[model samples]
Target chain A: MEIIKTSNLKKSYMLGNVEVKALNGVDTSIEQGEFVAIMGPSGCGKSTFLNLTGMLDTPTSGEIYLEGKDVTNMNSNMRAEYRLKYMGFVFQFFNLFNELTVMENVMFPMMLNKRSNYKERAKELLNLVGLGDRLNHLPSELSGGQQQRVTIARSLANDPKILLADEPTGNLDTASSIEIIELFRKLNQEQGQTIVMVTHSPEIGGMTDRIIHFRDGTIEH
Target chain B: MSSVFFYARKDAKKNWKMFVFVIMAIAISTANIIIINGFMDGLTDGFLEKTMDTSSGHINIYPNEQDKYIEGLGIKEKKLDGLDGVVAYSPRITAGGTLHYKEKFKTIKILALDPSKENEVTILLSKIDSGKTLAANDRDGILISYRLADDLKVKIGDEATIVFENGKIRVFKIRGILHTGLAMDTNTIIINFEDASEQLNLFNKASIILVKLQDGTLSGQYKNKISGELGIQKIKEWEQEIESVLSSFKTFRDISNFMNAIGLFTGAVSVGIVLYINILHRRRQIGILKAIGMKDSQVLFVYILQAVFLGIIGILIGDALGYAGTKYLEAHPFPDPTLGSLGPRFHLSLIYDASLVTMLIIILAAAIPALMASRTNIIKAIWGE
Candidate 1:
């Protein structure tokens, strides 16, 4: 049931003739329907690994298999198609489009994927996130936690098999953080969603079914 | 396509300030181009009409002149007797003369024409303002311009003495006043060729032959046939007679075109800056779009769609404003002393070709910025340093 797997992944960056290895020789796998948390200190390649796994960036040298289909060398347009059809992401900063209303923000991913029933699906997702009454409110009017909930709703719009969360609670208060975690738990336990989240908080990391801790560029456990 | 349209509408609504600014810039530039072109068209048409009315017939026939003094009196006359498309043929004697009325005298050019056939050569005589047209039996009657009558203190039926080159004197009565809306009217006089022949002492001679062809006939073929029959080396057409005037019009058109190009360039710059700022401000939105699996082309389409929206607004406004301005100018005309005694009136009619060219220029101005906006890179546009 290995839904996502990477073998000997390596990533590097060039800064003024000096090379920086962000992720070096990492191998990992996550089973289907598992809520997994990746834990690491700052600059420990957690975001890099998430980006690679989410298909936002390609590893320098590695093999990435999603549902047993190798996606390591996909072109830009092909990768975009794959991302639209099979994956969704929640960012650390709650990167909601300010110009769009809360409902419109949630509807963005579906619109991008050209879903025919985008409006109805968006309303349903907003209701599920408990923000149906605030559909017309813009992102700027929403609090950090509300915005994160809207982002979560948007991630589900395409019915993606794999949902990637990069510090989803990074910018929320304690109460908002707990509410968001409970929502994730509901989505994972009830709806059997497969989620891979990156977090610095041990408390949030502990709530996941499995935790992968990392230091520098290597997994510690 | 529907999704892109929806997003574009939202984006334009969100950035209404930039949108309005771009539209206004386009509109103003387009309006300027239209108004200038219209004005030029009006002026050129007015000049051409006056020239045709006062001087040259639609077609003129003259002897080929290899030398400067291909004497006007030496013109040969042939019987165009049974030509199917020939309308009217009038022979004329042209010479510069001086008229003396009271104590004042002024030099003028006289066209000694057959009184019965003169209307075929110059149509403006039919629009005479005072007295009667010259009759075939009237040997000593002359038709003088209204402005010349005013300058000479002469009225209809008053006698004016004209002095020909050989010191021959002929005292002629002013039979009528010709008022053409043109400058040449003030310096022209019409007299019967018999009296002109008696005064100048040139018998059975004419300076030029004018032929008014039937409407819709091929003037070129007729002109060539006439040239071949007459064995003349040079045959001048209506267009050739006004070569200098047409050249001036072409020069003005080129200047207007250059001005329109500059205006469009500036408009494009304004739109470009507006779009650049818009893209910079919406960088995060673009990033979010890309993260949501939107391709670069899709993101670029949104910006291009926005630019097109702005261009359409601009062109519409510009065309309206230009049309209104031109109409206003047409309705209110300034006095032109060159239009003789008929008084000045608004010149409105423009050449259709010029108007079409101006419209094309305006459209091109609006489209360049939109196309440029469509080529912007989504990732770089979004991820600014």
Candidate 2:
């Protein structure tokens, strides 16, 4: 069954007198537990599409269905509730709260969710991400690859159904990038964690189950 | 709510300097309002006590309807003296006169009364700096204030000649020196009533009657009662008689109120600016929190909790400092040359009310920033706008 489906999705925004079409007439579906890569050059709407799927942005037209439920017109608060329950995001910058320790950063979403077992779950996720020894370390004290690992751990805190990564390893070195890719591959293979990643790297795209290429605002199949 | 509290505590702990600065600013403002008000209260209370104890009794009776004397001055005085709650009553002949010592002449307010009888209602004998108060039989003996003595360069045993309104010159020996602790008494001289009546040639005439009440008697109630019974329209309570001093007291209160308003406004603005800056700086963090599925209300709760926590601590510290400062001043009062030996007093109720007001002001100051933070566009804030 398709976990997320979008039909003829379009998004337009204004920049001065120019209207930029970030996405146009995009029809797509991702089945459950699939590791997919959205590959495109800059300004091709890859991140915008990922954001719309993550409910971080709304499409100008068309419908978004999660498990056959249309959520295209959901308000910001309802979208947030859906994201909390079913979506996790990893940004290029890691986006870990600099002031919170690794353990606290991982537990933040769960705390907001008011999960009773958040602490134990955060600890387990940190250990799984190989950051168990650095639970108390702040993000600033961590290496680039370690910070990405902490971010991944944080993303998995709420046991989200889909992990939406926007250039998760874009800021890391080659070796760190490889390590992060391998971690994502392992999570997909072992836990069947459905993943959608936006990346310019052919190597990262090649590792995914399938790649959807984009040019201008439409998928190139 | 619990998560909000946790976040607020962590934030405050991490940024303790900001919290401490806000708290201290509020505390200082509260202390300023309390201390300034206390000083004004002390000055007013001291002036009232000195004025009342020296000349104006709690209630005074003058000639009714502009009459020079009550229809029966002796009879009215006796009736008031025998009334319930009447502590002491003295009938006095007050005349504007000129006192001459050697070649120097000075205008003076001269009061003629039996010093023994007047001392019962006023602080006469206790105010004497030297010599003795007038006895009933001491016809020519007079008591002069210390300021008058200094101005005239006269002392006890020096005789000063006073020319009354009737141009009758009478020489009376200065039997005692008075210090009334008030500036008005600087030119006051007291003489025996029999001598004054004889010299002024106004026999059986007294212009004013001063009445003291028993302790805890409300002066307003008795003033009205006595005025009605005596059919007099010129009676006044001590507060009414000392209108100028009371006006000065009101001026002091007005100034303190202005200062309090300024202090409170400063506290509000300080907290408001600090919170606004904090939200501006933390916009990215707020956006990220929102993107991570934290509700706007939750984020607002964290910020509001942080502010209220700091505000409450500030108010507590302010109240403590205000109370301590007031107590210290009460014990070791700041001396003023104008009101000698009077100390400033601050009521506990004043501190409590001021603290509550400060808390409310700070919370309101913090809310504007919290609302701004909550309403921020998550996408723009995250993108560093």
Best TM-score among the predictions, by candidate number: 2
Give one digit per residue, the lDDT tens place, for model 2 in A1-221.
79989999999999999999999989999998999999999999998899888888889998889878899999878988888888888988888887789999998889888899999999999999898999999899999999999999988888999899999889999999999999999999999999999999999999999999988999997
On the 0 to 100 scale, the lDDT of residue A188 in model 1 is: 94
In model 1, pairs of residues that clash are B182-B339
Residue A81, candidate 2: alpha-carbon lDDT: 84
Instruction: Evaluate residue A154 in candidate 1 and report its C-alpha lDDT on the 0 to 100 scale.
Output: 88
TM-score of chain A of each: 0.98, 0.98
Q: Classify candidate 2 by CAPRI docking class.
A: medium
Interface RMSD after interface superposition, model 2: 1.4
* Residue A35 Cα positional deviation in candidate 1, in Å, after optimal superposition: 2.3
Q: How many backbone clashes can be found in candidate 2?
A: 0
* Candidate 2: segments with Cα more than 4 A from true spot: A1-18, A24-27, A57-82, A186-194, B62-69, B112-114, B128-137, B193-208, B215-217, B220-224, B233-246, B261-269
